[model samples]
Target: MVRENPTASLASLASGQSFALTGGTVILEDGSQSASDIIVGADGRVVAVEPFLDTSSCGACVDIAGMLVTPGFLDAHQHLDKTGVLRFTPNPSGTLQGAREAFAKYARTAGPDDIHKRATRTVERCLSRGTTAIRSHINVDKDAGFHGIETLAGVRDAEKDRITLQLVAFMTPHPGQDFDWLGKNIDGAVALADAVGGTPAVSEDPPRYLDILFSAAVKAGKPVDLHLDEHLNAGVHLLDAALDRVERFDMRGRTVFSHISVLSALPRRDFQRIAQRMLDLDVGAVTLPAANLYLQGRDYEMLPPRGLTRVAELHRMGVTIATASDNIQDPFVPTGSGDMLEIARWTLLAGHLRGDELSAAHHMITTAPARLMGLGKDYGLKAGARADFVVTDCIDTDTLVAGGPDRAFVFSKGRLVSQTATETIREKEDA
Candidate 1:
């Protein structure tokens, strides 16, 4: 199923031959190059990047005369399987509690085929949006049953080469439970996943949950990711506890806290202290603006808070922060098309990240997320790097973000895998 007006796919590249992209703006990590041509070899690695290249003996050539080319976007965090829940349930309240109830009900009623169909559609939509990499969290809790795991595995296989899907088996263990059984199941799931996930503060007590997850993470030798401190309550200050475990087990930088929403609730002094600790401990923060904002604060009405991590403070403290869309069309967040441009726009508005912060936010969806996923080194269209990237309509970072996703001429490993129409109607109306 190849797309119409497809770019050169990585598979089409033959050794010793070069494919040239005629004209587009190429955005590098540090700067942007206009009217550039990117050449790729048969080995699927970028052979050369210059303003002009001699085009000869190439297996295929794509003349994207009027487009903007940049590194393929990466959704650092998402929930593909749970997105299927949206087809049946509408979380009108849009609270965490409402989401929990809706997901529980929908998971029971939904089967693997249903999940497969929806997840596949979601992934395809993501790819069509020029998102080539996604770190998806799959629910492994009992409530989701086999449907979550089965759906996740199918998605992983179906979109493996086209899109990089790093699966994190997510679950929340009960407190005072038999540790052995919990560890066994979690470890078994880790054996089948790229990483391990837990929701330390999502449970009753943050301390106990962190302890269990940290112990399991240490034992399994897997990078730990906890849905830490998602509430606006300062009482659920699990960041310190999680760092304590990271120090105890020496996991350090390998641990990431997703949606540290309670970070903003901490007093400035306390926040600074924890930020320094996280910096020293090498822990990272993953902020899920889409789902966190939607799921938190069912009890509040006026001035509902942005349930996201303290991104500015974290950056000031030298901690790495990345924005993610945790749930797309799921109970947690009823709508998302796996578009990080949308996420960036929302982040810019909600987080008040402007100018340099905007630049950093742009990196958050591209290089920053890719590096966090441990796959960005070869991600861009640089010499010796894999020819996996996208061509968009906007020329500069500001325009790119403002323009949203206009078109998705995506190439994976130098082969044309998918393409999507940019919302040109919006562009027309804006004009």
Candidate 2:
């Protein structure tokens, strides 16, 4: 399970006692920076995080110099299984419907081996970019079948120690309502995946469809994450219906909704009413700015909606929200480099988070996503937390949100997982 990179150092960094990362600026949860030392025990957990530390008892003292360290970034939502198929399955129309039909057609011939290869490559890229964890949704339907589930499981097992990976068994609620195939395996998918996902927004009846999804989650005893009303001017918000199920099933704090972009389409009063309900019911939300902006308002001619949710307002209303990359190089979204910092940067722009709020924008990718994923208190830049973090050239929140440079080093469980060497290409001579 420990995948040792051929180019990585053969000599293991694991040792007895502890080690200290000295001389780097550590960014705390509060967005404040301090020149500090972080001590990692041999077991790969933080034993001390402070401005100063005595490193006399450590096995190694890694000098990170001017680098800044922050908790490893997390993609609370992504599509690992479908990454890297952009060229083969281009969406000429560049609309959501086109993507659905195109991907479904290509999937018929794409076998398990194909899915594994693409998913693993994406996992590696995400790790290289300082993301230590990911929650991916693999399509599960009559079209893709359970093969996507097995493919996701294989990639996660193969890279077990390098990062945290969770799967969401995703089946869009439409497309022939193939209940015979889906109904037979829906519960099985839930049992296999870390969470269950579906788009009730596309179903014939939204509220009733949510109840069905909820019943499945309760039966499988897994949490739920759904794609709800991603289209703009959607008449009804399934978010309201989801709340009814939460109360009916007592499934508080165990539900999440992604791409609820229709919240932007709601009237201000209605938006606040639903926002208050989201806070009261303890439901979490994830905004996929890249795909949302790309697909949502294509039909409109002038002044189309931004396709972004009210991120700033959601944060202000005490609702748990995180920004994530929903698709990477797939038909639904033609572009995404698998960088969480870039996703955060887009959230700042598309979601209108600027100025002093940049700190919270950074949180949308790191801290907020970590908490929404329920990684617990042991997952951030804190004492006794998991020794998963990245060292980059950017120092403060502003530069971090801007995503100016690549990460210099990535560490997981107190061991070096990835390291980068910078080289600038010389520009061509003057004409």
Candidate 3:
């Protein structure tokens, strides 16, 4: 029997009590949507999800009939430390090196309070747009040191109730610092972070740099997320070096490669071989189309490449692939809104993802990133998973991914975190 409470309200469910979100088209594990009722327990976890869950024991039943319910979006790769600093650190050249130089200059005087303020604001923006989990990479070098890591840790603690934040100790190279400096400071940074990461392509010696990162991760039993070959120069690549390190450290299934933009320049055969290697090792990939498209291909005059990884090829090959907003309103890419759906749209257009593959594109921001972040067993619509989800008027995945709906209800741990709605009106035209 179906039971509906006439006087129930969605806002009432935020009181940390038992509730049932009934009559919604819930996105299932395989990216399919079905009309289902999600029963959330008093402890703020999903109790059951079925066509008609027994909500007789629930305190409130809010019907979301005609709405689309999906797991909260996840961003697997982002630079929170550098977000929202466009005005303070302008990249006039609008190139990758220029951004790095601008940020390095700013980092000389950047304090924890400033970093915390900017990062917290970005987190709020991401949460309002339905991102409940984020894995942000913080730079750790002689120039930036531990300011970013410490400040983001504070942000994570303060926003624990609203979002899940994982920090990466991104070991970067500085001109004044040698490999010995990284080797000396990496373990401490890794100790303070949830994962270890670095840009191996920019290091003086790629192999030695990767060895230090992998060795630290192995010692700490932490996951590895690397910014690998984030350029168009296919002649100079580091995928082989990184793969060898993954194999040496036995980091299979716990490693992720972000922004492999160079892969698009490789021939089909070479791309296929590398893709197979990634699959065999259970390594994941995250494509940051927004940053890659902006920073790469600037040296070309005509027929410049899309400057994105082969997202379609990797997806077709059954590799664990995802997309993210790498740098938001920073020197790296000065335009951003902290919205994952916007990232999805960019991926669709730049990566040549067909309209028929909307579900796959949707997964790039939701399930695919969730899997890459190792959000295992507790990040879905199934029973016992965390009741973190977004409610929108879009009826299916295609409508949700093509362009997000104007209105959305974001819930974290069964608590209403954000509710956004937009209304537009224009003068009536002559009929």
Candidate 4:
């Protein structure tokens, strides 16, 4: 009975208590599904994920048979503070320059309350979409100053229960120039955020830019997440330069690099070599396909590139490759839904993931990002892990990837944070 309508079934169950999810086909790390009865303990941790569990004494059970069960999604790269601001802000050309210019204009006047409200909405939207974790980038340069950092910091704490929000203080200074504002406010942003990030593509002196970014993060004793080589320049070597900083700072496994779009411009041999280097350094790659697809390849007239990194190659090299929604309705790309599944769909299309590789595509949004953000100590649909996951109305990954499945329920620490069910309505137009 519960299988047909998980929303109504879950609604009848008490909140904050442990229960068993019976007969559900839980998605494994490999994207394959298995029939496993998940027994969430009273403490909101999974006690067992075995096939055909004896739930006779479960007291209460929710039959999730045939549903797609998996760990909650994680967005490794996001601009939460800038979400839903396009109403007033306009991006006419849809180029990277236009995005920066538009945001620069808006950021100058956007206050803390406004930033907070929009960020809150984005966080709530992500939570409802089964993304229980987010690593959002907040601007800390001259245009936005520390307002983005401060506003998102508050939202991080407020939404702590629903989503594990990690703020990365990202500097958006011009290439070859340093912003004086971050000099005094860098500590403040680092004090409130989990990591520090910067764009090396725009930095005229990429090496020097990385030095300042790496130094600040080291001083703050946090990991570094960088927006490296976000352009289509085949000669761009920020990825190689960043490896130096990561090695010098010994930040391997503690570092993540997003938007390595130029990596695709490298030759196959060089790309393979760099992929191995990334694995040896324990660094991960985060591809923001949604924003990249929109912002990149605009200058090219014919046969434009997908504006994405070599996701499959890096993954094949055992390098953690995660995908995320980088910007949400802001100057960058101008389109976002705060939904990781949507990002996953785009990743599949833009990244050229097919067949058996589909599971890897799913991993890009779920388990892969969790590992990149260092949240894998006890994650995934495993026994003794936190009972934080999502259920979509699909039998397998193929169905789920095809889209249109609502996040019937989202659980965080064994508490249902969001619940929804499809209510098909037939209506006639009133004359």
Candidate 5:
């Protein structure tokens, strides 16, 4: 059962036990931190964050010798239905084209039972790795039809207590086919949602398709996310149209662009102008590094595309950029363990973001994604904040990312929901 007031109840749980995190450095925003003791109250909110623990009035105290404590994770973008399809079919062709083909086959063969089983396993792994929330896009096309919506909604409701799942109804149209029918169906889906989705860049006439989709989104008064320019083709300019419409519709901060891989190949001047426009429009960007790197570079033979978007530049320009796994162990890119830490590791290496930037990359998995999910005051660890956190074996943000925690202690609204441990022992055999 879902608690009426999760945060308050978590605070009440914390008030009962005075946990002392000794010898561990706490990570904070703005690139600085100090040794801190966090006291959670019975009401499920963090009651106090101090330099030392004064446990005079507490009933129980956990001595975290030198482990790490950090905010729970939030995965920005994923496909719950597709993620579960990976167990059987692995992408052999290894390009977006091939993956799309494989997805078509898998969607036809896969059933709701299969999708749910895989998704539940994947979500369990995410919780084990400290992720508390996810934004999964459910395909609502003619193939699976309403099955995608119903199945994902079921997954959302089932996992709601453990992990917050936001649903994005994605509309995909076949090439050279009329999207009128698909468009009507998309409108119907949007009517049932808090937001809508589009892939105008993938359409035959991107400018026209963009107009149709965003206009639909505006009419629905829902937020929008577009899969724009996902390939590194120099000729692709659909992102410009998408952004232009956002400006035209005054949907600043309500519009988002995901997977604009072409920007990585654009000239510095051109990229700068686009970045500025995104900042002006308050539009966010989501990059799926694993999927991009895996599915991209297919058409090109040698010196293939990097497959990553202009992430660093966007951040430098104050654009909100988040990272996503996109597909986990599916027909596309085929090998994901459903852990956001793995996503961040590859992202940091591929995106060339380091040091403090590493921490920023961490945010792409945590608070940044939360911000995009409309989880406003419910995102962090503080007084009046939801008591959602993970205890790990690291001292600060850097260590949390670098040293994959050996164990994760998870709590949602003060109730222990999950715990994980990975044990390994290596020693010299015959010295």
Candidate 6:
């Protein structure tokens, strides 16, 4: 039985100081929850995770009985540059093309200060909800003209102490501009960002667009994250083309495909074939259910299909898959709170995952995305890993992933960065 300790206080630990959190249920890498004590070293790395630890030498010891401790959530795919613009730019049609046009108009006049302020607010909201790291795709095109990349890089540096922000120079296509413009600007944007990304499906020539993106990533020694085949037209899909480029550029284990919703329209055999190729190439996939479900299947009047990729099938095929909040309160999504657990829940329902697979859903927001972001062994709740964790009142992984807890404590490198608790009031009625 788990014990309840409502009076337990979470003390902040500075850098170069050791701390211990005891009597908590920790979610391990293998999707199991165990009662353990997490010992954070003086260097802000986990020294040990055992059933009990010697806290005599630690500077602070906190008892967190009946709480669930897990690695901080990782949002592998997001659009920080386009977030929080619902008031100014609303997608009246609620379609993908409408959103693109809306955001393009907004970007034409948006300054660096506007982009920085909006992105910084989103980062704070994400951190308060237990997201320690985010991989945001900022638009890099003729309309935006590198403003998003320059502004977000500053935000990444400013928020380095509280959150880890990875920027992807999203090479977007615009009218009246040819591939030459993208080619000339991609290298410079990739130099300033952590990865190279683009929306190949929206380009006039998908193959050529993908080639430019892959070449830039290869030249810069960076990973490629692409918005691949987001529509439901399987006949006009580009997954195979992207896979061919993945092999041609030798980007194995360094390429991620986001929002390949076309997979939902393919037959089982065809999807299996593509899945096998992805596994062989060590390519990763991310499903943006929030944006896809809202933006796709709008033309169909009845029995509209869920616009997510084949998440359960991909997992069965042993493909490294993750889910993320693609857009937040913007024209693309128009609804999001920067909460990763909410994203996990959407994946659980829209991805057709069973109730028993809640642990797998939890991994979509944690370990799966971490691996896609190339965090490999540096993340998680293991010894020698960075001491980034989220403590919640939920007792197990299922409870945590279902809807999340009302109270949460976020720690980055063993330092308490954000904490939230919701209070409820009820009226008593006379019987």
Q: TM-scores of the models, in the given order? A: 0.87, 0.92, 0.96, 0.92, 0.87, 0.96
Query: What does candidate 4's lDDT look like per residue over 146-235, in tens digits?
Result: 888887888778767667899998877764355455566677878888998988777666676788888889898998999888888887
lDDT of 5: 0.73
Report the alpha-carbon TM-score of model 6 versus the true structure: 0.96
Off by over 4 Å in 1: 1-18, 31-36, 51-54, 62-66, 90-92, 174-180, 204-208, 421-431
For TM-score, candidate 2 versus 3, the one ahead is 3
- The window of 10 residues in a row where model 1 has the poorest summed lDDT is 1-10
Report lDDT (CA) for all predictions: 0.74, 0.82, 0.89, 0.82, 0.73, 0.90
TM-score of 5: 0.87
Clashes of 6: 0
User: Which sequence of candidate numbers ranks them by TM-score, best first?
Assistant: 3, 6, 4, 2, 5, 1
Give the least accurate 10-residue stretch of model 6, judged by summed lDDT.
1-10
lDDT of 6 by residue, 43-94 (tens): 8788899997887888877888888899999999999999999999988999
| Candidate 3 per-residue C-alpha lDDT over 115-204 given as tens digits, one digit per residue, 9 for 90 to 100 | 988999999999989999999999999889899998998888888878999999999875555988888889999988999999887777
In model 5, the Cα lDDT at residue 413 comes to 49
The backbone clash count of each candidate, in order, is 10, 0, 0, 2, 13, 0
- lDDT score for residue 33 of model 4: 81
Q: How accurate locally is residue 182 in candidate 6, as Cα lDDT from 0 to 100?
A: 83
Candidates 2 and 3 compared by lDDT, better number:
3
Better of 3 and 4 by TM-score: 3
Winner by TM-score between candidate 6 and candidate 1:
6
Report how far off residue 239 is in candidate 3 (Å).
0.6
Candidate with top lDDT is 6
What tens digits encode model 2's per-residue C-alpha lDDT throughout 144-238? 88888888887787776789898998966655676566667888888778888898877776765677778888888888888878888757667
